[model samples]
Target: MSTTYHAAAVVGCRIPKSKIFLTEKVRECEHNIPESRIKDDEFCAKCGKPLWVTLHKTIPEYNRDMNTLCTFRVFDIEWEDFITVAGPGAVSEVANDCEKPSQLIHLPASDVRKRMERGLEKIGLWDDNEFGIWAILWGS
Candidate 1:
């Protein structure tokens, strides 16, 4: 069988920008924002805005005929309001600390893909017809 990868839907909501409140927790040059990305609790450095302030829980259902036990976190923000639905091990970090990506690139997919040392396969998104059928039958 061929190795395939499927996307787990990530939805992002655009949060309104406001003045950043800096604490002793995250300090410039000392803190690892560029390395570890932003922790949910960390505030933005530019505007001191947080990347993820609130979380909205969502359950994904393939359809009425099938039952699925899965929860997804979605975000909607400026520049883009889309999230990649990485399958299982593809995003192991999200389940561990809720940081989603242990490493992140807010840039376009092509740019991000270039930086990735791993191979990325397009098994498609949740709304695809073939993916839906497959999900209904074998989804976790």
Candidate 2:
């Protein structure tokens, strides 16, 4: 079997995973308006060290013939090429903390499809006539 990478879309809303927030910060330095990329500060909302944010794409779906059907796809904010940002500290000290890391989140197709369906339902986009689930990768 050949392993392939899929780009996930930011649907409905987006949230960071916290582990990679700092990495995104560094990448923002290269951009003019860095605020667009930074979801929030690098510090973890719970712990204060540093946190990463994860963006999730939500799709709407419905049921038909004992099968789930997707209606429409909602695209959220798009993430730039960079990933994390630095936490509190000097530029030199935080510079090294910046690193765009590729994270592999194994989301089963079944679960993914289910979530998409639910997301679509929540947004009133569920369509029983439609079918098939689309794969979305982050930072794609």
Report the lDDT of model 1 for residue 46.
62
Backbone clashes in model 2? 30
Q: How do the residues 1-140 of candidate 2 rate in per-residue lDDT, one tens digit apiece?
A: 54433343222212232211222223313233355434666553344544444443322222323222233223222553222111111011111224333333345545544665575456454444443332334332
TM-score, each model?
A: 0.17, 0.23
Q: Worst lDDT window (10 residues) for model 1?
A: 130-139
Question: How much is the lDDT of residue 117 in candidate 2?
Answer: 56
RMSD of 2: 19.9
Error of 2 at 4 (Å): 22
48 Cα displacement, candidate 2 (Å): 55
Which candidate leads in TM-score?
A: 2
True-vs-predicted CA distance for residue 57, candidate 1, Å: 9.4
Instruction: State the TM-score for model 2.
Output: 0.23
